[model samples]
Each structure stands twice: as structure tokens, then as C-alpha cells.
Target: MDTVIAYLPSILRGTWITIAVALCSILLAVLLGLLGAWGKLAVSKVANIFADAYTTLIRGVPDLVLMLLLFYGGQQLLNDLGDYTGLWGYIEINHFTAGVFTIGFIYGAYMTETFRGAYLAIPSGQIEAGVACGMSPGLVFGRIIWPQLVRYALPSFGNNWLVLLKTTALVSVLGLHELVWESFTAGRSTRQLFSFFFVTLLIYLVLTAISDVGLRWLDRKYSVGVRRA
Candidate 1:
């Protein structure tokens, strides 16, 4: 108990880093997912092909391999380009930035499918009715499409978020001082591996439990006008 208390501050700091990484990554994933969904649904063949390739490629690759490649390979690629162009000096990629972007890029593929399905689930008649009623595209989307689309998307989105939150542990391999890394360090230092790991596990379970509650609240909020079949 004393050892656990002593290590608590470091673990809490690491947990904050983990939370920050997850939040930033989720936001980026959402943005990319929205764009990918739009591209897939667009009339242009080029757009559709690009979106398909992105989702297919990312989804097929192992996440750890993708993260390593994106972090190291991307850094090398950038340095090579800089050397060739002589436009800038060698650039160092921060671990946090690399981790967030890699996670976001990988999960964006899943989110793309989620958003696409949600959008497709929306009835065309609703859209047509909105247009006929002289509502602007933005107005229609905000008042009609967005709410229902979110209602349909919320479950998958919440699942992805929970998974992504756990995935932040992978960032520890890249030398990001997140929860797993901190816990491992504390356990090694104190020679109390079981204690520290158990504590870490409890923290994760608590975080996920809170997230589940919040997601349920959001689901109810979004489903206000939705008729359950």
C-alpha cells in the first residue's frame, strides 16, 4: 500500500498522457472518417477508389506493424525528402505526435466504414423532403440528418472509442510515457510487479466503466426522436 501510494503520482501523470493521446487520436480519426465517408459516397470514381484503398489497406495491416512503419519509416521518408530538396534540416518526430497520428490513421479506416454505414442508413426520402421544404443543405443536415446519423452511429463509435483508448497502450513501445510504461517502470523499481499491474488494470477498468456510462447518456440524447423497431 505504501509503495503503491508512492508510485501513484507517476501513474496518474502517465494516465493523463494516455487520455490526451486518445482524445487527440479520436478527433483526428473522426475527421478522416468523415472525409473518407464523403469520398466513398461521392459521384467521382477517383474519390471512391481513393477512399476504398485507404480503408482496405489500413484495415488489412497489423496495427503494431503499421505504427512502427509510420513512426520510423515516415520519419526516414521525411528526412530523405528534406535532404533531397535541401529545404529543411533533419526533423525529429515527437513520440506523442507519431503515436497519435498513427493510431488515428489506423482507426480512421474503421470509422470510415462506421460513418458510411450510418449515412447509408439514412432514408433518401427524408433528404428529399428536406430539399422540397426549401431547407438549405446545412440546415437539413443539422436539423434532420445529423441527429439520426449520430443515433445510428453512436454504438459503433462508442465501441471504437473504447478500443482506441486501450490501443493507447501500444504507444508505450514508442517510448511514450503512458500508463503501461509508467506502471512497468514502477513495478520494476519496487519489485512489486503484480501490485503495480493490478493497479493499472483497475485504472483501465474504471476509465472504461466511466466511458460506458457517458456513452449511454449520449445514446439516449441522440435517440430522443428515434423510433426503436
Candidate 2:
């Protein structure tokens, strides 16, 4: 409709923020996931217990609650630290940082499980073979375990990513200027509720579609040498 067209720029800007949030969050998630997976598999009982507690606590809590807690808790903690150092008054956390870290911290637990399963799926023989060839642990991981784990993890990773993309909508609750926030603002301003929401829905659909295609391409690329004839 004409109203939707008029709001295109606003919608696009919000979409950009949403994408940025998702990208940053996913990057954090992947890094944390890797570390968490390593911790879970570490030799030390302390490391294992810490990792287990993190995964269990994150998985058990509702994501929205976690997001709220992290945002408020982070703000308060920073403010307290600033006060201690006589830096200034309250140090506020912006919505973008809040949203990204919230999603990343929440999903990283799931990603940890995915990565762990993928690693376990790899046969012990491959690692042994690498060791027999006098490869260092790092080289063995790089040359053998890494590639296979990626291939196996792609499907689950893709699923998690798609879910993560959708979860970006929740960032609106924190007043982030993402798509849902923009749509709400536009709808309220214009009183064209259906039109703005419809546009928002379309944007989400497009994002999801693009992600699906990208994941598929990655899957193919990663599986190149191993695909059966």
C-alpha cells in the first residue's frame, strides 16, 4: 500500500540494525560455543563443572528473562564499577549491545551442545591416525577434526542460526530500533496496523529465506570432498 511504500526507508534502517544484531550475536555465539565446548570436554573437574553449570543455567532460564537480567545486571555492574573508580555516573548499555549479547549468550549454550555432538561424532581413529603420523594436537585438530566437525555440525548450526534470526525480534522488548520496533513505531504513528505489520512480516521472511540459502551453500561447500557420487 502507499503507506507501506512511504515507510520503506524506516523499515530498511531497522532491518539493517536487526541484521547487525544477528550477525554480531552469532559471531559471539560461535566463539563462546567453541570455548564452552572445549571447557565441557576439558580434563579438569572444575572446568567441566563450570561449563556444565553455564549450559544448564542458560538452557533452563527463559530467554526473555535472561535478556532482561543481563541488560539490567550489566548496566548496574558497570555503574557500580564506575562509581568505585570515580569515573562518572551510571554507565548505560545501549540496546544493540544488550540484544546481541543476550541472544549470543543464550544460544551459545545450544551451540555448545551442537559442537560437542559433532566432535564426538568424529571417529577416534582419525585422531589416532593423525597422532601416528607425528602430527601435533593442534595440527591434528586443524587437518582432521575441524573439517569433519564442521561438516557434521552444519545442519544443526543452520537450524540454530535460523532460530536465532527469529529471536532478534525479542530485542524490541529492550527498545532496540530493530525491525519489530520500527514496525511498532510506524504502525502507531500512521494507525495503519496491518500494513506496517505485514511489511515487518515480509522483512522477516526475506531474512529467513536468505539465511536458508546461505546455509545451504555453506553445507555444500563444506561437504564438497565427502559427498557420495
- Model 1 lDDT tens row, 1-229: 7898998999999999999999999999999998999999999999999999999999999888999999999999999999999999989999999999999999999899999999999999999999999999999989988888888889999999999999998999999999999999999989999998899899999999999999999999988876789
Instruction: Please write out the lDDT profile of model 2 over residues 18-57, one tens digit for every residue.
Output: 9999999999999989989999988999989988999999
**Each model's RMSD to truth, in Å?**
1.1, 1.6
lDDT of 2: 0.92
Decoy 2 TM-score against native = 0.95
lDDT of 2 at 40: 95
Best by lDDT: 1
